[model samples]
Target chain A: MSTEHPEEGRVVRFPTGGVSGEVDIGQLFDAHAAYLVRVCIRLTGSRAAAEDIVQEVFVTAHRRRGDLIPDSNLRTWLYRVAVNLVRHHHRSSGRFNRFVDRYKVDPREAPAGPDVDVERVERAHLVRDCVAELSEKQREVFVLYELEGISGQEISEVLGIKLNTVWSRLRLARKAFRVEWQRRHGEGDHP
Target chain B: MSGPRRLMDDPDFRWETDCDLGDEAILHEGLELGALKERVLAAIEAPPVPPEPTSTASTLGASGAAVKGALGVGLAVVAALGVGYMLGAAQPLSSEGVAEPEAVIEQVVSVPDARLPVAAPRVPAVSAPEAHSTEVVEPVASPQPLHRAPAAVEGGASEPVRPAAAAEVAAVVMPVQSEAPGTAEAPVGESGTVVAEVAAPGGVDAVDGSRLDVEMEVYDTAVQAMASGDYAGAVPAFRSYLRQFPGGHLSTEAELSLLECLFEAGSFAEAEAQASRLLQAPGFGGRERELSLVRAESLILLDRCSEALAIVDALGERDSRTAAVRRECKRRR
Candidate 1:
C-alpha cells in the first residue's frame, strides 16, 4: 500500500539508538521487498493482502535489524519472517483461509487441456492448489523447496525442524501431489 | 501439456513444472517493480517508525524457562501488591458530606503514609510466596519503589509490604459509600469536578476531584501484570478494580479491561458471562465499541459464530483492527 518510489528503497538512514550492525532498511527493502511480495502472493494468494503483509515484515525487520545474526542469510531470515507473518496474518485475519475457500484450491494440479496457455495457467493454479492441500507444515516444505528455491537444509534451519523432518515432509508432500495430480488429470485410470 | 506425458515418468518433472508455472518469471517481474516500481520509489523516501520491543524468552528455547517462570511469578505478585499499595486512601473532601471539586481532586490526594496499617496479615487466594516475596505485602524496615508507580504511588515508605495490607487497604480508605459499587459516584458539587473528569474517559484522573484512585490502583496492577504476560495475575487485579469501582468513573475502562484479561487468560466461559453482564449494565457507556469487540472475540472462541456476528454488526465503527476481528468472526460463522 506504500506508494514509496523505487529510488527511495535505494538508501536508508539508521534509526537512532539502534544497536550496531543494523541493516539499512531502505537498501534492504530495495533488495528484497519485491521478491518478498511475490513470495507472499504465492503464500497468501492475494495481491492487496500480500502487499500489506510484506510491508509489515519490512517494518518489523527494520526495527529488529540489530538482532539479526551477523552470519545468517538475510534472504532466509526474510523468508522466516514472511512465513511467520503470513501465518499470524492467517490466524488473526483468517484471510488465507478465505482465499483458499473462495478459490476451492486443493493440492491437485488442474487438468491440462488441449489449449496451451490455458493449460499453463491451469497448471500454475494446480501447483498452488496442490501446495495448499498440504498441511501447514507440509506446505512449508513444498513452498520452500519447490517454489522459493530454498534447500532442504535451509528450510530445516528456518523452520527449526530437523533435516530429516524437512525431507520427510517434502517426501509426503510430493506423494500427495502425485496422487492428486494424477487423479485430477485423469491419468491414473490407466497408462 | 504436450511435452509432459513421458516427463511425468521421470518423477523429476516437478522442476520443469515449477518453472512452467511462471513462478520464476513472476519472481523476476516482481523484482522489476514494473508499475509498482513507481510506488516503491516514492515509498522508500519516507522515514521509518520505531520498532516494537519483542519478548526474547518466548522465542528462545527452554534453556532458562524455569528461572524465567519463577521470576515472572515473583514479579507478578510484587506488581499486584505494589499497584494496590498505590491505591492507598483518600481523605474526607467536605464536612457537609458534599465533596468539593477542588478539595477532593483525585490526583493530588497523597497516601496518608506509605506504610499501610494492617491489623492482621491475610493470605491471598493466589499462590503462596517465600518469605522475601511475602515481605513485599507487609510493613517492612525500608521503603522500596512501587514498581514505577507515578500516580497512585505518591511518596515512599520504609518497611516490608504485606499482602494483608493490600487486601484490607479499604480500612484506611476514605468512606465514599461502598454501599453501591454500581452508583458509587456521588456528585461532588456541580461546578469544576464531576462533569469535567467524566468527559476525559481514558485519561489520568485530574488533581481536581476525580473518582479513580482505587480503581486506577487495581487497574494499574492488572495492566502491569498483563504487560509482563501474567494474565492470570491480571485477571484478579482487573476484577478487583471492577469490584472496588463498579460505578466508579473508570468502571467502563475497568470492565473492558477485565473482559480482555479474562479472554487472554483463556477463561472463555467466565469472559462470556462477564461480557453478557457488561452488555446489560446501563452504566456501560463509551466502551460499547471495545466491549463489543471483546464480546465478539469471546463468542468466536466459544464457537458461537452467529452470536459473535450480531455483536460485530452492533459495533459502531470499523477499521483495520476491527476488520481483522470481524473477518475471523465471519469466517467462524
Candidate 2:
C-alpha cells in the first residue's frame, strides 16, 4: 500500500517488502516519475519517447534492485540511469536534433484545449532546440539545474561531476544557449 | 530544495521565470503524469516475453517454457527485493530535501559496472523508419526580440534544426556511430544530413566484445546500404543479418527493416506478406501499431482497399497517420 506525504504529495511511501529488502519501487515511482519525465522530455524532445525512457529507467532500477542499499540517494541514482539512457537514445538515433524534429509533436496538431496556445507551444519548441545545441555536458547540467530546478550540488551528484564543474559548465551552457537563442529568435532578443 | 547558489546577473536570460510561460511550466504542462505512472506499473507487472529460438521461429514448446520460468524467477527475485525495500528494510530516500550529506550519494551509488564502449557504441537494434512520418516543416522563426538583461530566468529547449531530409516514399534510415578513436571521417552524410557525435561506451568481456563487434559491422553494412538509397543492396544485407543471428536481440528489428526495404523497392506484395507473418509472431506485442500501419499501406498499394481499410480501422481513428491511410483507402475505394 502507498500513501502520499502529508505535505504537497511530493513523496509517496510504500509499506510492502521487496526481494532484497530495499526501497519500494512503487514509492520511488510515485515520487520521482513526474520529475524524471519532465527532465527526459527536455532531454529527448519527445513526450512519447520521454515516457518510454522513464519506464525503462524504472525497469532498469528494478533489475538492479540489489544496488539500492540504505542511504543510497535513489533520486540521484535514478537520474544517473536516465542520463545514461538519454545518451544512448541520442547516440543510437543519430543527429538527435533530427530525431527531435521527427518526434516533436507539431504545435498545430497539439492536443486541443482552451489552455493550449500554439504560440506558447512553438516557443517552447524553440527553447528546446536551443538547449539541444549545447554540448552534452552543458546540456545535461543546464537541463537539470535551470529547467528541472535541481540544485547545483544535486546536479553534481546526478552527473558525477564536481560542484565547481557543474557551475562552470552551467555558465558556459547559459552563454551558448543565449547565442543560439539569439540566432533562432533573431539578434535583438536575448534568451 | 536547497536555496540556489549565487546568481550571475543577466537580464536577457530570464526565460525560466518570465511569465506563466517559464521553461519549467511550459515543459510540465500537457504531460499526463498519472496515466504515465499507470503505464509504468503495468509494464513492470507484465510477463516477460521469451525470445524466439535460434533453430526456428515457431518452436516454443518446452524450451520456451524453461526460458520463461528462468526469466520469471529472475523477475520474482527482483520484485521481492522491490517489495522488501518497500515493506521493511530499505525505506526509499525521502524527497524531503535536495541537499543530502555528500557521503550518502558517494557510499551508496557507484557508477554501474556494465557500459557500452565509449568509442563507436552501437545500439543493438534499429527501429523501422516508417513508424514516423517525414512530413516535417521548417521551424517558424521566433517573433519579437526580447531584451537580454542578465537576471536569473528559466531553461530552454533543444537546438534549432532544419528537417534532415525531404519527404520521400522511401527515406533512407541508419544510425551513425560517433567516430572511433582513429578515424578521420567527415561529420556530414553525402545527402547533407548532420551526424551528431557522442562519446563511446567501453568495457565488456572478450567473447561479448567480439560478438558485438561483428554484429555492429554487419548491421552497419546494411544501414550504409540503406542510407545510400540502395534498397536492393540493403535487402540482402538485412537478410544476411537474420540468417547470421536468428535469435539475436535485434532480429525483429532486422526483419522489420527488411520488410521496409521490400516496400520501398516497390515490392508491395512481398512486404505485406512479411509484415503479416511478423505481426502474428509471438513476443512482438508493442510493435503492432507500426507493423499494422506498414502492412496496411502495403495492402493499399496492392489495390486491396477493403483489406487495408480493415487493418486501418482496427487501429482506431486517432493517429494522424492511420487517419491519413483511412482517408486514402476510402478515396481509392
Candidate 3:
C-alpha cells in the first residue's frame, strides 16, 4: 500500500514484515519535466522535438532503474542525459537547421487584452531569433549562463567543456548577442 | 568611449546604473529571461512514469531459468558437447574466408582514392563522373578485355581509345570474379591482380592507414580557421579535403563545411552549388538536412529569399533542426 506524505507529497509504501520501500516517480517528473522540456526546446528550437526528447529521457531512466546512483542528483543527471542525447541527435542528423525548421512553432498571435504585453512578447521573440542565429557553441553557452542562470562550474559540467572554455564562450556569446541586438535596433536603442 | 569607461568606474555599477532603455524595459528583459530559463529547465527534466516491474521480472526469471536449464543439459550432454563446439568454432572461419574477396572488392568500389591506403591494390572499379553518384558495376560474366587499360592513354591515342581500354578491363575481370568460387585465383589483368594480391595480405594495412584521422585533422584545421573568422583561409583547406576524398566517409561533413567556408568568403553561388550537390545525394539523410538549412540561410543572407523559401519548403517538419531553420527562412521570406 502507498500513502502520500504531507510535507513533500512523496509516496510512502509498506510491504511484508514491516519492510518499506517507496518510489516517487510522479514527484520526480513534476519537479523536473518542465525544466527538461524547456532546455530541449531552447537547444533544438522545436517544441515537438523537445517533447520527444523529454519523453525519451524519462523512458531511459525508467529502463535503467537499478543503475540510478543512490546519492546522485537525479535532476542534474537527467539534464546531463538530455544534453548528451541532443548532441547525439545532432551528430546523427548532421542537420541542426533542418531539425529546428521542422519542429519550431510560429509565435502565437498577440492577444487584444490590455494586460497582454505586446512589447515583452516581441522582445522575447527577437531574443530567441537572435540567439538562434548564434554559432552552436555560442548559443549553448548563452542559454546556460544568461537564460538558465547556472553557474560557470555547472555549465562546464553540463557541457563537458573546460571551465575556461565555458567562460570564453559565454563572454563571446554575450558580446555577439549584444552586438546583434544593437545592430537590429540601431545606434540610439540600448538594452 | 571615455564616458562609458567612467560609467563603469563607478563603485556601485549595478545600483547606480541608468540605461537608456528605462526601468520598464529592464524589467521586461528580466521577465523574458526568466521565462526562457523556466522553459529550458522544463525541457531537461525526466518524465513521470514509474519503471515497469514486468520487464525486470521477466528478464530475471528467464535468465535464471536458462542457467538452471543449461546446468541440467550440461550434465546430460557432456559426451557430445566437444564435437559440437569444434564444429561451431570452425564454421565461422570457413564462411569468413569465402566472404573476404567480395568484401574487399566492394570496399574498393565504394571508398575514394585518397581514403585508400598506399598498399591498397588499385582495382579500376567504375568511377562515376559526379563523385557522389552511384558507381555502375559492369556485369561479371562477359569479361570485356578492353576495359583493363590504364586511365591515361598514350600521347598519340585518341580520347575514344582511352574509354575502350577502361571498358575492356571492366568486362574481363567482372565476369571471372562473379562466377568463380570466392577463393579463386586473382584475375589475369594487371589492375585486377594488383587488387587481388592486396586482398591476399589480409587487408590490415588499409584499415591501419587511418584515413578518418587524416580527414579529422584537416577538418579541425578548417574549423579553427572559421573560428578565427578567416573564411578565406578556411576555403582552401575544405576544398582540398573534398577534392582528395570525394567519396570519403566524411564527404558529407566536408561538403557542408565547404558551404560554410564559401558563404563566409562571400562566394554565395559556389556555396549554393555545393549545397545543391549535397541535397542531390541519396545518403544525405540526417545531419545533411541541416546543411541544406544552413545553405538556405546563406541564401537568405544574400537576399535570395525566393530560393531560400523553396529550400525551406522542401524540408518537411521531420526534425527540429529543420523546423527551426524553416522558421527562420519563412521569417526572412
Candidate 4:
C-alpha cells in the first residue's frame, strides 16, 4: 500500500538480496555519518573500532528503517542506534572490551608539530587519555551528557538505565576525570 | 529543569570542572572525518556479511571470551534465521495480508543492550499511480541460511510470518512439553505444521520453550523487532506482550514502546488511541513526558494541529526536538 520513495536518490540493497526499495539512508549518511564517527571515536577510544561501530550503526539503521519514527528527529534515532551499537560492541567483547577501553589510546590524536606548542598538545593528549581511562559505563554516561549534549533522561532512554543511575555515573565520571586531569597536569592548570 | 541542559547548566562550572570532556574541537584533533566519509559511505552502501566486526581487543580480555564466542555464532545464526525468515515472509504478506499488521513491536537490543524491535517482517509496498506512501521496508531476511528455508506458503512463504527472535527461534527448534499454561509448544496439530503461529485471536504466540515466563522471550522479540525498525513487526509483538502479561513488570515499558512503534509505523490513528490509553493508565510514573511527546507527534500527523499544540503547550518546557516538531505542525496548519 505504501509507494513513496523519499530516498529515490540512494538505494540500499538488503543484505538478503533482491532489488528492493530505496531508503534515504544515503542522505542520512551525508548528514550525520561524521558526527556519529566523532561520538564513536570518543566512546570507543580507538579510530578503528569507531569506524567499525559507525558502519554497524548505518547498516542497522538501513535494516530497521521501518521502525524509524517518521517526521521525528532522525538524528535522535541515529544516536540511539549508535549508543546501542557501542554498548553491544562492548558487551560482546566482554573483558577484551574493558581491556581495549583501559589501555587503548585513540589514533586520532596527532603528535606535536615542530611549530605547534608542545604544552597544549601534551595537555590535550593527557585530557583525551584520561577521558579514555574512565570506566566504560562512566565514560559512556559522561560522553553522552557532556560531549554529545544529550540530557540525562534521554541518555537513560537510549542507554536503558535509570535517570538516577545516569546521574550517579556522570557524577562519578566527573570526579574521576578531575582526579585524572590533576594527576596528569599537577595543580591549578585546566583545559 | 530542562532535560539535557539542566545537567550542566553552568558553562563555567563545566569548563572549570569537567574541563572540556565533550569538546567538539577535540574530535578533529588529528583526524579528518571528511576524507573517510566516502569510504565509510561506500561500505554502508554495501556492508559486509558480519554485522559487527570482531576486534582483536575482544580476544585479549578475560571477560570477552564467552561473550565474543557466544555473539559471533549467536548473532550470525539468529540474524540469519530470525531475520531471513521474516524478510522472505514479509513480502507477499503485504499485499496478501498473511500476517497481523500490529504484531511488529521492537524487542531486545542485539548488543546485550537487548533493545527489542523485531526486524519486522514487511513486504515493500508496491506502488499504484494514484496514492503515494513512504512505507519503509524491514530487511528481515539475511543473505545466509542458518536453518532450512521456511516451508513455502501462499503468495510466497507458506509459514504465517510472525516476527520471532533468536531465543524464540531456538526454543521453537528445541520444543519442551509441559502442561504449564504459558508453554508455547509449537502449535502442533494433524499436519505436523511447525510454523510459528499465534494460537489465539489476539496475537499471542507462546514460545515452544519450557520456561514459565516465556513472556520475556516474547517481549524480547518484540523489542528486537522494534529496535530493528520493523515497526510493523513491533506493533503486534508489543500488543501480544501487553496482552500476555498485562500486570507483568515490563508492561509499562511495553506500552510506551508500543506507542513509539505505532507512531513510527505511521499508524497515526492507532498511535493516537494508544497514546490516549497510556495517558489514562494509573502507574505511568516517569513515562508521561515521553508518552506526551508521542501524543503530540500522532496529533500532528493526524492533522489535529490544535490538539497537538495544546499537548506541546502543556509540556511548557518542550525539548528542542519536540519544539521543532510543534513549529512545523503549526506551519502546516
Candidate 5:
C-alpha cells in the first residue's frame, strides 16, 4: 500500500496491506485527513465545502472499509473518494459557488508565510482562478499534480485513468492554466 | 518517442515558478489539520444526513415546474431504472480482482455527468397535441439536446429550419411561454415545420415551462447582443448564461457564442483556451466541427499554425471555411 502525503511536509505511514491492516479509522484520519482536506479545499475553493466533502469521504471509507484489499493503495482510494465527492458537490451546487468562491479567499485567514503581501495574495487569487478555469477532468489532474505534488502514476491510480490519459489531461490543464493566467494577469505574461 | 511533460521532470515549468510561493501556502492559506481530525472521526462515527436536494436541474431547459410534480414522477421512475442499470453494470469498485480497470475508470469519471436529471426518458406525454409531442421529446430525448426549430423561429419566420436557429427560437419562445401560454398552444401550418412555426416553442413550454424559457431568454439575449456586434456586452452576457445554465443543452450554444465574442474581440488566446475547455467537456458533441474551426482559427491567429493544421486535417472537411483556415495556417507556417 502506498503511503504518501498529498500536501508537502505532512507524511503518512500505511501498513503493508493498506487500510485493511490493524490500522483503525482514526489512524487513517491522522495520516491523510489533513492532506485530503487541503486537496479538497483547492478542488472546491471553499473551506466549508472542502470540510464537508472530506468528512463525507471518510464516512464513505468507513462504510466501504470491508471493500479494502490488502494490495489496494489506501491513498489512491481516498483520493478517488474525495474527487468523486467534490464532483458531486460541483453538480449539486452548480458553477455559481465556484465563481463566487474564486474571489472569496478570507482576509482573516491569510497565507501561512511570514512575508505575505498584497501582491502575493493577488497572484495566488489569479492562480486559483486560472486553475478554476480548467474543465473538471483537467482540474482534477492539474490540482493533484501541480498543487498537491502527487506523482503521475499515483494520480493515474487515484483517478482510475490510464497514465497516458493523465499526462494528456495534465498537458491540456497546464496550457489552459497558462492561457487563463495570461488573460487575467496580463496579455503577454508567460505565467 | 517523447511523452507528455511532467512537473518533476521540468523544474522550469512548474506553477511555483509562476508566482514565487509554494502551492500549499497559497492554496491551503495556513489551514491546518489540527482539531479537524476529531471532527472527521466523530462524523464518521455518526454519519450526517445528506443535504436536501437543491432546485438545480441537471438538464438545461427543464423547468422547476417540470421537476416539481409534472415531470418529476415520470423522470424519477425512469431515473430509478437508469440508476439500477448503472449500478448493476458498473464494475465493482474494489481495486483488486478488476479485469478492466479502464472500464471502471470510465464509469467512475463519467458518473457526475450521468446523474438523475439526464435520465433519457423519451416519454411523449406533453400537454400539446399528439403531433407536437414528438417535437418536445425529440430535443430532450437526445443526450445532447439542441435548440432547433425554436432557434429559427426566434431569429425570424423566414429563417430556415436548422439546428443553428434553435438558440434564437429558444429566446423568442421563452417570453411567449412566460407571458401567454395559450399563444404557444395556437395552431400553425405544416407538420415538418411544426417545431419552427408553433410546436417547438409550445413544445418547450408544455414540457419544461418557464424554467427552460428563462434559460433560453438568457442565452438568446447574449446571442442577440453578439449578433448585433456588441462583442463586449455579449461576452459577459454569455458568461452569465453559462454560469446560470452550465451543463444544460443550451450551454453548448452559450459556450460557442462566448468563443465567437472572444474571437471577434481579438482575444484569440482566450478564445482558444475556452474552445479547448469546451471541446474537452463531457457530452461535448453536435458542434465539434464548429468548435474545432474556432479553435483552429484562434490558434492560427496566435501563430500556432502547426496545431491549427493538425485540427484542420483531423476535420477532413474541404469546405471554404476550412479551406481558408488551411491556407492561412500554411501561409503562417
Candidate 6:
C-alpha cells in the first residue's frame, strides 16, 4: 500500500513483491523538464512551441514508464526522444518556407547587451550575413566545425554524413568564406 | 613533400602568425566563431525536463480516472490470483479438506470490494462483457454529454475541456469489462480498457505546426551567412532564433553558429558572453571541454592571452584539440 503524508512526503510501499512501487512524478518533472524545454526551443525557435513539446515528452514518458532505460543514460534517451518529436513536428508543420522568410535577417546585428560597441557589432552582423549566403552543406560543415567546435567525428554523428565529406565541406566553406570576405572588404591588390 | 604540405611548410605560406588577412580581420573572425560555439554549447548542455503529469491528468478528467481505476482493478486481480495459487499449494490433503476449500472460496468471494475501493462507484448488475461496451452500448452515458454542461457553464467560450474533466468523461464512457471471468489472464485486455477510457476527442492536435521548419531554415540561413563571410548577418540570424527559443532543441546549434558569427564579425564581448552562458548550462557536460576551448579562443581574441592560455592548459589535460590550439597560441605569444 502507498500513502501520502503531508509532513513525511509521498511514499510508495510495495506489497511484498510488485513493480518496484510508484515513482514521484513531481521529482521526475523537476529534473528533466527544463532540458526538454531547451531542446524544443533550440529545434523550434519558439518558447510556446518548446513548452508544447515538453508537455508531450512528459506525457509519453509517463505512458511508457516500464520502457525507460536505466539511470546512466536516461537523459541521453530523453534527448533522443525529444529529437524524434522535433523531427515529427517539422514534418507536420510544412511551413519551412514561411519560417525562412520571417527570420532572414543577420543575428549579430540584433539588439543585445548595451555593453557592445555599435561599430564592432555592425561588422559582426556583416560577417554573419555573408556566411548566411553559403550553400546548405557548406554552412552545416562550417557551423559544426568552426562555430560549434565539434570534432569531425561528432559532426558526422550529428549530421549522419561521411567523415571525408565533413573535411571536404569544411575546406570548401573556409575557402568560400575567405573569398567572400575579401570581396566585401575590397581586394588589397595581392590577390 | 606533397604540394599542399610544401605550401603549408613554406615560410611565406605560414598558417601561423603571418596573417595575410591582417590582425583586425582575424580577430573579427575569431570573435564570431567564439560566439557561434557558445550558442551550440548552450543548446547541447541545457537540461531536458518534461512537463508536469498531474496537469495533463487533470485535463484528461474522468477518462483519466477510469484508466487509473482499471489499472487498480488489474493490480487487484493479479494479487488475488497469486493468493489463490498460494492457498491451493498450502491446502491439507484428504476428502474432508475439500469442504475446507469450499469455505475458503466462499470467504474470498464475499470480500468483493476489498481490493478495489473505486470499483464500487458502478454496480456490477451488467455482465462483464456488457460492461466493457458501456460507452458504445450506452451512448447517452457518454462523458462528452457531461462535458457539454461544463463547457457551457465556463461561458460557451470555446475553452478547451480541462484535463480533469477529460479524465472524468473517460471514466464515465469506458465499458466496465472487469466482470468477465479469466479475462485478467490476458494482460492485453487491460490495454484496451485503458485506451477506451482515455480516448478523448481532439486531444492529439496540440503540437505546433511551423516551428521546426523555421528553426531548420534559420540554422541554414545562419550557416550561409557564415560561408559568405557575412558574419554580421549570421550573428543576428542565430541570435534571433536563440531569443525566440532559448530552450530550443537546436539552440545549441544556433548558439554555436551565433558564436562563430560574432567572433568573425569582431564582436568579442558578445561572443564571450554567449560562451559563458553555454559553459553554465548543465546540458553541456559532454561538450563543455570543447566549448571551453572556444571560450579560450575568445579570450585570446579579446587580448586576454593569459586567461586564454590558462583555459587552453586546462583543456590540454583532456582534449588534444585544445592542446594543439594552446601550443599555437603559445607560439604566437
lDDT of 1 by residue, B131-247 (tens): 111111111211223344333311211111112212222221222222333342222211222211122112323222233243344445555555554555656655554444333
**Distance from true position, residue B161, model 5, in Å?**
18
lDDT of 2: 0.49
Off by over 4 Å in 6: A1-114, A183-191, B1-333
lDDT of 5 by residue, B34-65 (tens): 56676665655453333212212222224223
Query: Tens-digit lDDT track for model 2 on B1-333?
Result: 353442223343354333121533565666677776776666555554233121111212232333234223322222121110100111111111112333223212211111100101112333332122122122122221212112211110011111111111111122222334222122343344333222221121222233334434454455455545555666666665554434332354456557756765667798889778877776444346556777777787777878988997785422234444565566566
Question: Which CAPRI category fits model 6?
Answer: incorrect
Q: Tell me the whole-model lDDT of each prediction, alpha carbons only.
A: 0.44, 0.49, 0.42, 0.48, 0.52, 0.39
Chain A TM-scores of all predicted models: 0.73, 0.77, 0.76, 0.73, 0.79, 0.50
Clashing residue pairs in candidate 5 are B147-B166, B150-B169, B151-B165, B151-B166, B151-B169, B152-B165
Query: Higher-TM-score candidate among 1 and 4?
Result: 1
Lowest lDDT sum, 10 consecutive residues, model 5 chain B, at: B153-162
In angstroms, the error of model 1 at A94 is: 2.1
Per-model fnat list: 0.05, 0.12, 0.01, 0.13, 0.19, 0.00
lDDT of 6 by residue, B76-188 (tens): 23222211111111111111111221222222222221211111122221112232323221112212211111221100011111112222222222222334321221111
Tell me the deviation in Å of residue B81 in model 6: 52
DockQ of each: 0.10, 0.10, 0.09, 0.07, 0.12, 0.03
TM-score of chain B of each: 0.37, 0.39, 0.37, 0.40, 0.38, 0.36
Considering every candidate listed, which one attains the maximal lDDT? 5
Question: Candidate 1 regions off by >4 Å?
Answer: A1-26, A95-116, A188-191, B1-333
lDDT of 1: 0.44
Residue B244 local lDDT, model 4:
44
lDDT tens string, model 2, A65-169? Answer: 433455456677778767755654443233213322343345522445787777777777777888878887899988888777788888887877888888889
- Sort order, TM-score high to low: 5, 2, 1, 4, 3, 6
Task: Give the distance in Å from residue A52's predicted Cα in candidate 5 to where it truly belongs.
Answer: 1.0
Q: Poorest 10 consecutive residues of model 2 chain B by lDDT?
A: B111-120
lDDT of 6 by residue, A40-152 (tens): 54345444445544554544444445444333234444444454444434322212213223424513314456665665555544455455555656765664455434467
